[model samples]
Structure formats: C-alpha cells, structure tokens
Target: MRFSREDLARVRLSAAPDPLWEVALSITKLYRPNVTEPYAEWAAWTRNVDDLRVRSAARVLGSLIPSRGYFPDFLTPADGSPSLEEGIDAVLRTPRRKLRANLGRLGRLPGWAQGLADGDPAALGSLGTAMRTYHDGMLKPHWERIRRRLEADRATTGAAMLTGGAEQVLSGLGPAVRWRDPVLEVDYPVDREVHLAGRGLLLVPSLFCHGTPVSLADDDLPPVLVYPIAPGRDWMRASAPERQLEALLGRTRSAVLRAITYGGTTSQIARRLRVSPASVSEHVGVLRGSGLLASRRQGRGVVHSLTGLGSSLVAGDDAPWPAVNSAQPEWCRPTPPPS
Candidate 1:
C-alpha cells in the first residue's frame, strides 16, 4: 500500500478492538478445517456450543462469510464506533447502492441473500439479530480476555510510536507485513494495492485475525488493517493462580495484581477493581517497590504492567523467585497495611 506524508501523519491505532470486525473475522475462523494451536481449543468449544440461537446466528453469518474468499465490506463497517449496537446500526443503514455493489462482487448470491443485497428491511433486521446473538453467545463470554490482549498490543504499539514514530510502528507489524519506505507490502491472498490518498490508515489489532493481515476489499472504503495478536497461554482460561496469590497478598491487593494482567493506569486499574484511586496508588506503590510491577510515565499518568517475576507468579509457573534485596524487594511476605 502506498502512503503519502499526510497519510503517515494521520496513522493511528484503534483505542480498542472493533467488535464488528472481530465478529466477521471470527466467523471465518469458525468454518476453517483443522484449525491449529491458539485457535484449536476455541474452535472446538464453539463447535460444541449447543445453543440453537447461536447455531442459527452462526448459519446466518456463515452464509455471508466464506471460509476463504471475499466477504462483503458492508458487514464490517468502519464507523469506528466501539458499541456493537451502533456498529450494527451502521451496517443496517448501509446505502442500497453500496450494499448491492459490495455483495454483487461475490457473484451468484443465493436467493435468500438477494433480499439482503437488495436492501430489504426484513433481511437487514434478521442480519442485525444474527450478529447480536452470535456476539453475545460466543464473544461476550471471552470479551475481557480479548480486550486485555488487544489493549496490551495497543500499548506496545503506542510505546513504539512514541519512541520512534509511525515508521517504527509499521516496521514492527510482524513478518507478514514489510515496510519499504513509501509503500507498505502485505501478504494478502490477492495481489492488490491500496493507495491511502491522505485518508491515512487505522491499525486494528484483532484476536481472531489469523495469519495474514486483512483489509477491506474495496479500496474506496475507509482504509483499515486488522492484524492478529499473540495472546498468552492463560488468556482463555480463568486465572486460578490469582486466588492463590490472594493467600500471599490480601484480597484487594491480589485483585489489583490480577487487574494489571495486560497493563493500565492507576485510574483505569482503580475502576477495574472498583476501588478508590488513592487505594490503588498505595497498592501499586507497594507492588512497584517489591519488584513485582513496573511503571513508566505516559503523558499525564503512569501505566503499570507486570514484571517478569510478577508474570510467573500470576501464571503459577515454577520459576524461582528473585532473591531479596533493597533493589529487588520480595513480594512473598504479607501485604503491607494500606496508608
């Protein structure tokens, strides 16, 4: 893809994962045969889900999104709304001409889909219902894990951009993408070029986008690149180790540590734990001093993330704890009384 100076200047990462994009991409993953590690367990679980509503919803989405091929761009609108309801509303509100043009590209749609292509109201309503049902059933259960993983990715990308500019962010988007000055080359199924004529690009990190990065097939639409994230081994499973840590640290302190699985500011962490900012700050100071967490200034507030020792502790690994010292304090002792 070709990028101009304005395009480069306007480049920004999505603050959070796009729900519609994820729902569309995840549908593609669900239909794939012999899915591999990272996705294998999820695919298995989804296949075994016995809800008739979910199954019906999946069928509706599956009919639109092929396992490997072009899906309608209207399905994944680029309105940048974080709310799924708003996104779906945007989808349902797609102009008839645009819908026909996008769906027509697929060639030879089924009779039922013709109604959707012709912008029939009943068809649009059914589509919206299917999307909501599928998302609530499949994605909602794992939304927290998904949000944490994407937020962590955004944090890493943001740090790179802060340190070295947009070029650094582009260069580091994994091996599937290559940054060669003016043009960014991607490993797409079809050989295509997207020239962002000063509109810039939206970089979205997705949990369901596997292998090569995906973008809208239509160049005329808003330019977006949805890439995959490498989630931790415990990403899907509930962290039982947090409960164990509660034995070492008190309940509130343990809750604070668990809240920082991905990373957050004091205020963000406080909101997650539903505690006061002062309480979070005191707990964070202790965690930071004990060498279980690290904090760095970002703009007005500091972002805190787990240190190596803290990560192992949270994951319940058998790695030996760091020796006690003034520089590297121990966190194994009882939680200090909050000031």
Candidate 2:
C-alpha cells in the first residue's frame, strides 16, 4: 500500500492512548462497583475456592490488568499458612514475567522474578496492593480526568450536532480543559511526544507516591501511566468508525443497543459513550444507513431506534454489516471471532 505523508505522520504519532486504560477500567468498574457481569462471573468462579484459591486469585488479578495479560499467579497451595516469599516467588516468576513481556517493558522488570522465585507468598498479598498502587495511583487519576473531559465534550458536541459550526461548536464550549505538568514520568521517546503533541493526546509515566498526609514512600512499584495527550483531542474524531461494524454500528449506536438491552436514547447513549450529541447523531446516521436502526423526526429532531437487524447486531451478530470502512482511517470495529 502507498502511504501519504499525512498517513505516515499519523502512524508515527500513534501510541496507545488513555482509553487503553479501559482494560483496567473494565475490571475495576465491573468488580469494584456494586457487582457487574464480569465481576459476578469472576466471583462465581471464586466462590467455591478454599482460602488458597482466594489468595491465588487475588495475586493473579493483581498482576493481570496493568500488564493486561492473564497468568495463573494464583493456583498454588495454601498449606495451612503459605510462605510470603513463596507466594511472591510464584507471582514474581510466573505471572509477573508474562505481564512484563506483554507490556514490552520486561527488560526493565526486576530480575526479582528469579530472586523472588524463591520468596514468600504472604508478601504477595502486599504485592497486589503494590501493583494496584502502580495502576491506581498512577494510571487511575489520569483516567478519571480524561474520562470526565471526554464525557463533558460529548455533551457539548451533542448539543451542537444540529448546528454546523465546528468552530462555534468548540468555541461555545470554551477551552474546556487544562492539564498541569504531568504528575508522572513518561517512558515514550521524545519524537512520540512530538507526535502526540500534534495529535492532542498525552502519555506519561506514573511513578512514585504523591499527594498524601506525609512524605513519599520508598517502597512502591512505579506504574506506567497512559493518558490523553491533547485531553481535548480525545474527541478528535467526528466518528472513529475505523472498524467495519463500528462504522456501521457506531460507538454511540453500540452504546444505544447496550442501553436498549437495558434501554437508552441519543442523550443516554451520548452520556454513556462520553461523546457529543452530534457525534451520537452521526453514529445514528451510520446505523440507520446500514439498516441496523430506524429513526423518526419528532418535535425538534430525530429519535432513533434499533431495527430488527440492529437487534441481531447487538446480540453479537456482525456478518450482516459490510466490511467496507475497514480501510478508512476514520473507521473501525473489531468484532471478536466467533467460537
């Protein structure tokens, strides 16, 4: 394939941005909140475990998210009293190895895997806390900020969807964002930063303890922080339907269907997707065009509803949609392979 300078520019500019935090966000939002589906499923799996399973599951889930890879850190013996060193060794050696490798930061990992390969499992309880700290203290705060900004942007975007001023649309909203000098160490190359700067997304490294009753604690694992570079550019896309189904179904559309399964509208879908109403309208257009949705003009504007096809689309059916937009830089959808 031939590449344009602009295309290459965007490629060089690419880095996993803030929403990548969605992996952790999914876990926490599911399990941490009142029970969610995944959490309920996970809990169901753990319910039968004796104490040993409990600790092992905790250790494994701890290592899985930041690393976003699954390894069976839990599944060892909880013999009367497990050794802290043994637990640490099990996780440090097995799950931790998998985690580092996946993040592509394994070289930076402590050989503590081999060292703790023989350490205490009890220490692993603290290990979850440590890993959580790296993820939560580092990535989480930034995530909330980005999510909040994205959500707010969506509201204003929705309000202006009927109107046509990208400038006035944005201007009415004001600058709408402010980010202080990063509170974390970023590990990306300077060129990547340059790229991100242009794209309006920022990725930083979150290392060490900050904002507390006292001083910094020396014993904490530093987490890699990934967040929006342009904070505002989080809304850079009019419609990022890079994937085929996404182009057709739309983020807002998918959100709407999900809500429909639960029940939702353009306003509600916008609220859920953290996108603007106009963005929602754009998605609704795609869905309606694809015959996956039906819309009617009500008092002031359009009200959209899922068609029978939309119902199937939401039920995990993807074959009906054309794979036309896959090559469009602005569209995307990654439907999982059927089992």
Candidate 3:
C-alpha cells in the first residue's frame, strides 16, 4: 500500500505478458465469480464454451490453491513473459526447499502440490500436464485476441505515461486501484502493504483480472502489479442481429458473422461458440469466399472482421442484395429487425 521514494523513483513499465499467469487467473475467474464480480459474465461464458478438461482442472485447482489465498510464486514467476511451456518447466524445476517454504506459508500443500515437498517427479509431471491441458483448452483458444488486447493496453499506458506521468497513468489504471501520494492503494482481498524496496515494479495487464490489481504472494519476490483492461467492443456485442440476416444466413453462420464483428482468429471464434476449430474454419472460409468477411494475418493466426457487404447484411441493409424474382429467396427475406 505504501511505496518508499526509492521504489517510486524506480517504478518501471513492462509488458512481460505471461500465459502462465493467464492460466491461473482464468482458472480463478471460473472458480470464484462471487468474489471477482467483473468475471461473472466471463464465468458464464466459460461455463458455456470452455471444454470439459479446462472446467475440471479449474475446479480441482480452485478448491486446492485458492485464487484469494497465498500460493507459490514459482507457479507463476514474473520474469519477462515466458512461454507456457517454459513457465511449466520452471514450475517443474521449483526447488524443494522453496516449494516447502511457500506451501508452509499457506498452511499446507494441497494434495496435488505435496509431491513437490518430497521432490516427487510424478507430482511435478502431473502438475505440468494439467497446466498444459488447461492452457490448450482455455487460454490457447483466445490467446490471439488476448495478446492483441494486452498490446493495445500497453500502447495506451505508454502514451498516457508519456503525456502525463507515471502517477497519472497509475491513477487512470482502473477503479480498483488508487494512486495516493507516496502509496498505491489497491483494493485487495485482505489488508496488505507492499514496500517495493528499490526493486521497482512490473505492471502486467490481465484480461481475467477482474476487480483489483493483484500482487505476487511473496513481497520478497520482484514487485509486479497485475491490473485489468477494459473489455474490447467485440466482447460486449455477441448476440445482436437483424431478423433478415438471420433468415438469409441461417442461424449458425449468422452467429459466426456477428462474432466476426468482434475480430478474432478461428480458434477464438470456435472457443466462443464451444465448437470445433475445423467447423468454424469451414464456415469462415465459405464466408471469406463469398466476400462477406475479410481476414488479415496476425502472428500465427488470422483475425477476421466483417466486410462492407457483411456489415451491411448484419445491419439489415438488403440494399446490398438485389431483389430475387423467385418466390422463396433466402427464407422469404423476413422483415429485418428494428435497427
């Protein structure tokens, strides 16, 4: 809660985005919606869309290593954004002494983590396997969109800091965080003050970080502040459609079209709908061929958005399509929904 002058002076901004943290936080999101209300909607979405494996892992981990209580920092080390594989490897390599100490701080090591106290290889392997499976089921599907959103936040934060100052940017972070003079007050689950010492601070933007900025369990560890970024426009507009578009495109494609407006990759869309990527890709390919959707490469995946024709179609503009003389033209061209 209070930062010394040295800590304030050493404050630094870095976007070391880590998938490991996302994995833990997302599991937390599904596990504890009552505490983190911002994630209530997301929890519903995850329940509807996340695979069974992810849900199962979340339940198990949530019961054991609570999202609110102290957990091992090595589970999610804050050293520059490590890949999921690398982070898991690090967890597997956690020193027995360090693991024991961290778990002791939390009272007892959960059954799953007890192996680490004895340096059991099976325990480490099992943990790694579960984490990897959870990542593939939950985070990987939406990582492209997540990465883009975090990158946008990074740019925005950098701009704010440049134009105003560190204090200004910190003050503007979110409602849950406050920039009091000589102290950064965060609405944590419990009372805690982190004296940053001279270690400075690492600011990590998180999508699943709902209500408050989260700091690591151990104050001795490198100081990092994980805060939430406002959801993108696509996140809020999943289910709006004109009746005419629904009839013309059928229910599934129409839904896909609406989802494309949010601009995400194939995996992201598939995950959103709880369907297979292959199925989504088939539809996306068809839509792309029909000039209803456009896509551009982003990293290893493609981000799809509505084209002019597609946008018009969804917006109830039959003007884009000339009238067909046939009695039945795409489900009678039903009356378009009110704009």
Candidate 4:
C-alpha cells in the first residue's frame, strides 16, 4: 500500500479488537480448520459444541462466508462499533445499494440469500440474530484470551513506535508485511495495492486472520488492514490461572501479572482481582523492580504492563532473559510507578 505524508501521520492502531471482523474472519477459519493449526484445539471444541442454536447460526453464516474467496464487505464495517451489538446494528444498517453491490459480487445467490440481497427486513433481522448467536457461542468463550493477545501485540507496537515511530510500527508487523518507505507491501492472496490518499489506514490485529493480512476488496471504502496475531502458548486451555506461575510468584503477584496481560492502571487491576489498590501497588512495585513489569504515566494514573520477561514467564516459556539494550529510547526506558 502506498501512503502519502498525511497518511503516515494519520495511521492509527485500533485500541481494541474489532468484534465484527473477528466474527467474519472466524467463520472462514471454521471452514478451513486444517489450515489453522494454531486454532486446532478451538476448532475441535467448536465442532463439538452441542448447541442447536449455534449450529443453525453457523450454517446461516457459512453460506455467506465461503471457506475461500469473496465474502461480502458489509459483514465488517470500517467504523466497527466497540460493542458487538452496535457492530451488528451497523451491519444491519448497511445501505441497500451497498448491500446489493457487495453481495452481488458472490454471483448466484441461494434462495434464502436472495432475500438478504433484496434488503428484506426479515432477512436483515435474521442476519443480525445469527451474528449475535454465533458470536455468543463461538467467540465469547475465547474473547478474553483474544483481547489479551491483542493487547500484548499493541504493547509491542507501542514500544516500536517509541523507538522509531510509525515506520517502525509498520515494519514490525511480522514477515507478512514489508515496510519500504512510502509503500507498505503485504503478502496478499491477490495482486492489489491500496493508495492511502490522505485517508490513512487502520491497522487491526486479529486472532483468527491467519497466513496473509486482509484488506477490504473495495478500495473506495475506508482503509483497514486486518492482520493475524500470534496466539500465546497457553491460548486454548481452560480458563484457570496458571498454578505453576502462582506457585512461583505466589498467588497475589501471579494474579496481578495475569490481570495486567491487557495492561491497566492500579485501580483497574485492583478492581479486576478484587483487591485493594494499595496491595496491588505493592505487588506492582515488586514486579517492576524485578524487570517483569513496566509502568508508564497515562494522564493521572500509571498504566502497568508486562515486559517481554513477564510475558514469557506468564506464557510459561522457559526462554532466557532478553538482552538489555544499552541505548534504549527515552520512552522505551521504564518509568517509575506513579507516586
């Protein structure tokens, strides 16, 4: 993708994961489970879910999103609302002309889908209901892990930005993307180029988008690049806190570490773990002192986040400590926790 000076300045990473994007991308993964090795456990569990409503909903979505090839762009709006309900509302409110144009790309449509293409109110309502049901069944159970992984990716991106700015953030977006000054080349299934003509780009990290990064087929729409994220080693397991980590760090500290996987202020983590802010502060100090955490001021509060060491430890990796950089950027250097 080619970017102008204004585009570069306007590039922004999503603060949170896009629910509709995940919902749409996840449907693709479900059909091609063999290609998604990282999601094997999730695939197996999803297949065995005995909910009839979920199965019915999946069938409805499956017809729209093929295992490969074009799915309608209306499913994932560029300005995806923060909540799933709002996102679904956005999908349902797609202009009739836009819906026809997007769904028309699919060529021949099924009898039921014809209603959807025609902007029938009942069909639109059904689509909204199915999306809500499918999300609750498949994605909701794994949403926390998804959110945490995205947060970790954002933290890494934040560090990259601190070190080198937007260019660094683009370059560090994994091997699938190459940052070559004005143009960012991506490994896409099709030969295409997006000219961000001062409109900028929204870089969204997704849990379900595997292999190559995805962009909307229509260049006229808002520019969004949804790329795959690396699911940590412990992503597919049950929701129990790691006993081994707890044993090593003791219960409160371990809980504190896990809570900060999504990064939070003192009161935020304290509220999450149901502990007093003072106790959380004490533990945060120890963790930061040991190089397992990093704290930086954000407005009135200090936001605590896991360092690479803390992340590796939390993920249960036995990797050696990362080498310390002698010339770390000022922002990359750790800040003292807020007084």
Alpha carbon lDDT of each predicted model? 0.80, 0.35, 0.68, 0.79
lDDT tens per residue, model 3, 1-339: 567777766666653357777887776655542533444444444554436666555554554456455556777876644456768888888888877776666664456667766779987787777888877876665565476567568778888878887778779988888899878888887888787767878888888766677788778788888888886434422233445667878867776886676477887777555468898899999899999999999988789998999877766321222222322222212222121
Instruction: lDDT for model 1, please.
Output: 0.80
TM-score of decoy 2? 0.24
TM-scores of all candidate predictions against the true structure: 0.75, 0.24, 0.64, 0.75
Off by over 4 Å in 4: 232-234, 239-260, 264-339
Count of clashes in candidate 2: 36
Instruction: Encode model 1's per-residue lDDT on 38-156: one tens digit a residue.
Output: 76656666755668898878877877787777888999887464657778999999999998998887777766778998899999999999999999888887675677678779889
Q: Clashes in each model (backbone N, CA, C under 3 Å)?
A: 0, 36, 0, 0
lDDT of 4 by residue, 245-284 (tens): 8778997898899879878898877755547899999999
What C-alpha RMSD separates each model from the true structure?
12.6, 19.2, 12.6, 12.5
Task: Give candidate 4's whole-model lDDT.
Answer: 0.79
| Residue 288, candidate 4: alpha-carbon lDDT | 97
Candidate 3 to native Cα RMSD, angstroms = 12.6
Q: Residue-wise lDDT of candidate 2 within 8-75, one digit each (tens)?
A: 23221111122323323333322332333322333233333334433443333333332222222132
